[model samples]
Target: MKGIRFWAFWPVAYQPSSLQASQPPSLFGLIGRRMTKGQRRKLNRIYFMKYCSNCGQPVIHRTPPGDDRPRFCCESCGMVHYLNPKLVVGCIPEMEDRILLCRRAIEPGYGKWTLPAGYLENGESVAAGAKRETLEEARAKVEILTPYALYNICHVNQIYLMFRARLKDKRFGAGAESLEVKLFGENDIPWEEIAFRVIHATLLKYYDDRRLGRFSFHMENISPPNPNPPKTDN
Candidate 1:
């Protein structure tokens, strides 16, 4: 919050108040109402840009000449910065009747069971990233079989790509990012302790495919539940 500043233009009716100085200005009020806290937070993360990366000058949020949506633009350098979703790659390491899982040692969903997956690095292919993450987290070697499931998590701005993979051997151990690594059968999966919703969805689909004796590609959109729903006048 220290580095974040509110520099967006506001309507003449509103004045910058000292009480709300730490928070970003509300844009929804310009159209007549205030947005929910969750909505504003999501919007702020996506659009907030204090300084332009090109010229090290302050940026303004506005639509470019040809673009429909507003972006952080630099007046000094004439640069428009676009924010995009990140790709997360991972694979389910299968060894006949069992698959591998790791207990995370990190903050988000710590101590919970999850597949060997992480953010895809630059200059890395999707399949290669999946294998690298698998080896890094679970210390396991896997051969990617096929692309299994894709999840579009709009709320968090992430695209998860899960792959079906076969374990090269029984040799695997916990890596630095994992508290422990182990294999679990379909029935032995800890349903309640799964890390993220996308991972949970991938596992559910994977087991379903296994039961049918066939594997197929899957795609889904995942979002958080809305706390406030607009009401219509009767």
Candidate 2:
């Protein structure tokens, strides 16, 4: 079950660029380059499957007769396992001149602030998943106004769909996944403590739209963060 959760919710099947000769460049590996040293090591440590889930037999990592790329293939049951990217759905919950954020209780960003978001469940609509995540993470109810942004995070092999939402009421508290939930005005936002780059990008665009007195849907492709960012003389 833990393996299944990791496979579904976290990044996987990441092969570094050095190994891209035989196969295509791994978009998942790009995430490792953007992470801190410790975080990069953690992502690098997750290995591919050794056994097949279908028949509980050893699986071989090789390209089958027709497939272009390699996959986990089961000889005993003839099952082929494929790795796919995940969709992360969330909302920017807005009230009176403020937006809601939650302090994470889970790793990868434990104790840091983030918007309510999680993996989109199978068979669920993106808008419904965003609302459900808001309720689950911040204990807040919101009406999704419209999709504010769509991010293609190639590094993590994930798609982030963020919606503009209006808080139904002021009543909200921390949920099981959050240590605390609170509202923040533009000036009060903790820029350095944002949990993920994709979320940070969405927030930046949101505030930009606000300043222009209009909200527009946006789509962006994210690249790996620069490790050696230019130092500014302060």
Candidate 3:
């Protein structure tokens, strides 16, 4: 019985020779896989030598080797490109039975509908940033009721925090960043035309959760659609 079981599970447990083969090569992988230790060190000395990404100045000796990964120092601007994560704040503001939406006047998705969202300013709280963005884009004052989502967008290196908010006053108009602003009920929302994958996904989740008479938050990276990319330069 043990032999029979082992035979039966062998295919499942054992990796095939083809599957065990090395990873498909990339530029970095090929360099890493083929290079000798000395060659790798030479490559590292050439490519990974400390250089300020901000000012393009060499920063070879400043950081201690024990640090493993150290940020470059820029003497000219006193800047460091530490590659910190950016904070993005968004809000789903509701009034009565309708939700607020804005048509962007900025690049990346001009004239497309979206939830009020933007990068968090320095020293601003996530909720404060969300409320501020709502006011800035839609000219509407919002009271944050609860968090709606916390997403990590790795491609852009941003951490997004979304909130469910209540509009203090329904009176709103388009702000400088927005071409138009309006409230839409579930049926009236332009499902097909909504901009920003995160916004669309949040709305769908919102409606789905609403049907169950409950509110739940979601967190995921929703890549931006390229069909109608922002056309600020044009």
Candidate 4:
């Protein structure tokens, strides 16, 4: 456990193999309770694509004429329904030496700490989405510094992209989607309350690069059965 240490971060998200001591937080592990709306939504990709998008028709699960993967094919219309991973965009907003974090207003990790990130809405660039999320959750403007981390949570079909940003001012408060928002220095980060592994991984990388006086982009697959999908809009 002593050897497994990471600089704590709020999630935009985590990956598994990087740690020897910790596993991703699981909503199911908390208790053998029913899945929350947030948890259930993560699996919506599997169950929700019941109709064809191109034409309003019930879809059938089958491997279409030539495709190797099973798709939701419309019997009435020739359209196939394909489910893809959801993209979440956020940023590591920094003020002086502190970083901003939001207490989730929604579940699977309700009340947990996370970076200011959410699903990228249609017609928005990655950079725009990241900056918008920061403002929406933390109520703060920022100067996006650079792209920082990208995490793929295959099990839950989510990809989180996080950026490095400079907070425009210190006058931020919790947004409507957040319970509370706060800033913390590196050592003061709330590791146990962290919302996702991807966020944690991104934070560790941020501090490492800061110490080296150089920030570099990172990409990693946040391994399987990712149970801590945010209940928020993402």
Candidate 5:
């Protein structure tokens, strides 16, 4: 389990980039240009399987007979494991002049403000997942309008899908994963204390679009902080 009830609802396999193979940590490293040893270790523990799902045999990390890349393989049962990126779904829930937000009661940014969002469930639609996260974290009901932002955070092997929505009503409270639930006007937002870069980026765009009187889809690759980068998706 991706504990703490934060954004990381599920564990994902971490694959080191071949391009980042042996370079020293540099400015580009902050942007996922390279995978550090710590990064490799963090992912391996969560994603590397020890036992074959097909059988009760221990698995080995190796390339298959004809495969070029390394994989988790079971010699006894001939099972192979492949990993992929994860999808994080959430929404920007808005009322008349404010946006609904949750102060996380979980780690990976405990007690900080954030949009209502979480991991996309295996079978849930993207918009449905966003709505679910909104209701789950803020106890706010919302009707999703349109996708507002998409972030390709390659550094973390995760993608973010954020939607713009209209809050059903003003009635809301903190859910299990939040310390407090509140509505924030753009000027009142906790810019310095916001949880993640992607959240900050999304909010910035939302406010900008509002001023422009036109909302358009936004896509960007987020870069990690150069120093003391905060944990993102657990």
Candidate 6:
């Protein structure tokens, strides 16, 4: 479960060329000017099986290596495949001075708490994704308050957007993805049992922002720890 979640939600990091020049090159780069055509082809084949980041289609084959660049051709839509970040959206919904949270019933963080969140669906706006996740996980309607936190999980390669929201009514229950649904004041939140670093960070930010009566948005990159972090899903 942890492995699956790590691959699904974590962000992948690429060292910038400028940064690389300042430090020792990786073993692969040290041996060559660039990835060899054969190496790029192999990488492309692996990438295609992971699906087209653009159209969600399984890329059928590697494109002919061209100009020493990696390329893949999608079979479903004939689109070129290029690695890109996937967008995820979530919301922290507040009602009566408490924040809504869900206990995930699925792995990576089974039994751990999280804000309602999931990947953005095709043709959906970020806000729509947030709303949909809220409904899907908590069975509640909420009004978006403001942008909250934006984070890049670079270990697996995902961009997360969290929105501050106000519950339309104090009416919600556990939905498909959740084992339980409840609200918690800051002091009562299960800090050590939270699902992910991003969620923990977001909750911290929310508390600070609420106390100051000031709302501001920020972004950060979160790296997963080595040796496989503990699972939080129920």
Scored by CA lDDT, what does every candidate get? 0.83, 0.83, 0.73, 0.77, 0.80, 0.77
Give the per-residue lDDT digits (tens) of candidate 2, residues 116-135: 99999998999999999999
Q: In candidate 5, which residue ranges exceed 4 Å CA deviation? A: 1-47, 65-68, 228-234
Return the TM-score for each candidate structure.
Answer: 0.82, 0.79, 0.68, 0.74, 0.77, 0.70
- Per-residue accuracy of model 3 over 124-216 as CA lDDT, tens digit each: 998999999999999999999999888877655678888999999968999999999999999999888787777888898888988999998
Model 5: how far is 222 from its true place, Å? 1.6
Q: In candidate 4, which residue ranges exceed 4 Å CA deviation?
A: 1-45, 225-234
Cα miss at 57, model 3 (Å)? Answer: 3.6
Residue-level lDDT for 70 in candidate 6: 38
Worst 10 residues of 2 by lDDT: 2-11
Q: Give model 5's TM-score versus the native structure.
A: 0.77
Tell me which residue pairs clash in candidate 4.
10-115, 11-199, 13-198, 13-199, 14-197, 14-198, 107-231
Better of 2 and 6 by lDDT: 2
lDDT tens digits, residue span 1-234, model 5: 423222211222223332223333442233333445555444444445767788978766556767676677677878887767889999998899899889999999998999999999988999999999998998989999998899998767899999999999988999999999999999999999899989999999999999999999999999755756577895
Q: Which stretches of candidate 6 lie over 4 Å from their true place?
A: 1-69, 74-79, 228-234
The residue-by-residue lDDT of candidate 1 on 1-234, one tens digit each, is 434433344333222331122334554342234445555575556545678899988776666777776666788899889988999999999998999999999979999999999999999999999999999999999999999999898877899999999999999999999999999999899999999888899999999998999999999999885668788899
- Give me the candidate number with maximum TM-score: 1
Off by over 4 Å in 2: 1-21, 24-47, 232-234
After best superposition, candidate 4 residue 136: deviation in angstroms?
1.1
Residues 1-234, model 4: lDDT tens digits: 324323322111011222123222462232223455555454344445545678866665556766776566677878767778899999999999899999999886899999999999999999999999988988999999888888988877899999899998888999988999999999999999998888888888999998999999999998765458668774
Q: Between 2 and 3, whose lDDT is larger?
A: 2
